[model samples]
Target: MASSTASLISLQSRPSMAVARISTAKPVQGRSFLSFGLRAIPSRRLRVSCAAKTETVNKVCEIVKKQLALAPDVAVTGESKFSALGADSLDTVEIVMGLEEEFDISVEEDSAQNIATVQDAADLIEKLVEQKQKA
Candidate 1:
């Protein structure tokens, strides 16, 4: 009985070690293959659009700063949340209005409510702008 119990523990430990090795090896190999395949593809449009999105985020940061009456030294970035920057609900609404006016894009009420961070606003603005351009 003692021998069987010891053997069972060893069996469990050995399988866990093998599982760890297999899991680590699979992700490394898979990631390398995926990265190589992705690099082989030409993606000019994706690169251009990513640059444009970055510009949009920067613009959103500026607008948020201006709307909140933040001091020049107060840093606003893509991750900056409006509430964290001392903006109340009303201030957020005004910011949305300001963004609409500046971007010349009408944000639906649902979409406006979804703008929590500068990045969220920027992404929403980009999507709205694309839709507007398409129409």
Candidate 2:
């Protein structure tokens, strides 16, 4: 009898945890409302479209191939590595600079060093563009 009542109370409390209700009080304008009583504010994520990503990759590839002076016979895909494409350190730097000028975004030194493949450069460019738009 007592144990059954305790179990019922626990079950009822569990449902409250599952369902969330917004308070009737309106949140201040231009501010995000917090869910439940959590202290951590959730961050808003920027959504990137597939077409935008593809366009970035194509543009990056074009810059890389042109900067490296690669022949048209050579195919540059996302998986193609900079080294395999005959891009040395200087060429890589030039390519990064070209990307900056084309995308109108600054690339940090650490991030520039991390780009080893076409896909990597494209992904970094996309991220930089997204951050720029958000700011």
Candidate 3:
């Protein structure tokens, strides 16, 4: 009787594990469908804004290269991180100051600290510039 009971318990646990696997698999399918739906909806809006963002990113790359005193041969892009370009904390502060002067927008200390990449700084600059225009 004891052996029979243990076998039954194991059988019961196996089905639960199978159910858990099925549940997890289902959510993965649901998420992919949700993401596809989201992408289709935003494509038009994203294309419109992407053009302006690309221009901002290009300008930011130029500023980052100049601020870091990089050689002309060195390439800077939106994806380039400040630390990877040899910018320490002080260098980063100076870069922020340069961006402020170039963009004619004041960056809050907290917002400045969040800028780890040229893209980040460009996005923040654009946001601030937009806010200033609205005001």
Candidate 4:
């Protein structure tokens, strides 16, 4: 009975390797321990009603035209492709940067790379704006 009790005590005294592995990962400086992989959503929210979505699309169209230096005669519709609008890769990058600045939202690299048309960008911007508002 004493030998069995001693073995149980020894087992309880040993630290868990799984716990050690978890504790080895240091938390990022200036962030709370519970905030791992959690991004802070800004308290300031943007209006994201349907009307606001329409406005966002209009604003995006204007920004695209301005960024690409498109002639006023060129009609930019939501369906208009950026390449068809004479925007190359560099131009697209600039346009995306402009959208980020205009909308006050950060676009992930993958999302930014996938935008191909005016509608795509408008839709993405609308979604991000809504997400920001929710956050």
Candidate 5:
């Protein structure tokens, strides 16, 4: 009768061990709350992504300044018009092409035609970068 009780206890203990093994195997299913909390945690990639954005913007600004023949000391706040810098249609085309090449992005002819200010160009470049990433 003692042996029978011992075996029963072992059987019960074995099930608990099996449960622990299963839970460890599938941690998400085992600790659903923990998984939920972990999923909400911010990722390191987010910081890198934001940094890349800042770099891209800075690069775009530099490219624009070079293409527009603007002095290095000049600020590119993105509000200056292409014509304001004495950029004719051909010069603007070259500028747009430079932007596309530097960013590895495409700017539609229609979109390019609509961009009037320096800020508009920067905004467009940023948008293009975001769109490419999503794709």
Candidate 6:
């Protein structure tokens, strides 16, 4: 019985190495810095309210694309935020201003400070829009 237990422990401790015979491995090309794939990985992204997520993502992407001098059709969908868009402090301020103009609303300097990402801006704007519409 002891020998059987010992055998079981030995089996558990053993590493099973399955050799996969490689046929061909194409080298992955280095991705461009502006590529959206870098930020698509969820662990690297920011979280925001569902109501504002989509619009905010698109707006932020627009800002990034514009800054990078990309054409109008440039895609900026979900998962892209200020950091992923490569926005700096001045750019953030400009983006917030643009958002204000787009939404036709007032975003106070103090209130704007609390915003950290495109999602944050979108959530705030969405709530503000809802409040204004209700009123």
Q: Estimate the Cα RMSD of every predicted model relative to the unseen true structure.
A: 13.9, 14.7, 13.6, 16.6, 16.4, 16.2
lDDT digits (tens) for residues 1-135 of candidate 1:
111111112124333321111111234534522111111222233322223378889888888999999999999988889999999999999999999999999999998887788888888898889999999
Measured by lDDT, the strongest candidate is: 2
For candidate 5, which ten residues in a row score worst on lDDT? 1-10
Better of 4 and 5 by lDDT: 4
Of 2 and 4, the candidate ahead on TM-score is 2
Q: Over the full model, what C-alpha lDDT does candidate 1 score relative to the true structure? A: 0.73
Per-residue CA lDDT of model 4 for 1-135, tens digit only, reads: 111111111123433211111112334574424211222232444644333366777888999999999899989987789999999999999999999999999899999998888878988888898899999
lDDT of 5 by residue, 22-70 (tens): 1112345344321111112222332112223556557766777798788
For candidate 2, which ten residues in a row score worst on lDDT? 1-10
Global fold similarity of model 6 (TM-score) = 0.50
The lDDT for every candidate, in the order shown, is: 0.73, 0.75, 0.71, 0.74, 0.65, 0.59
Measured against the true structure, the TM-scores of the candidates, in listed sequence, are 0.62, 0.61, 0.62, 0.60, 0.53, 0.50
Error of 6 at 105 (Å): 0.8
Candidate 6: minimum summed lDDT over ten consecutive residues — where?
1-10
Stretches of model 4 off by over 4 angstroms after superposition:
1-52
State the lDDT of candidate 2 residue by residue for 1-135, as single tens digits. 111111112124343332233333335675544343312223446854333377778888899889998898889987789999888999999999999999999999999999898888988888888999999
Clash-forming residue pairs, model 5: 78-118, 78-119
lDDT of 2: 0.75
The TM-score of candidate 5 is 0.53
Candidate 6, clashing residue pairs? none
Error of 4 at 56 (Å): 1.5
Per-residue lDDT of model 3, residues 68-132, tens digit only:
89999998887789999999999899999988998899999999998888878888888898999
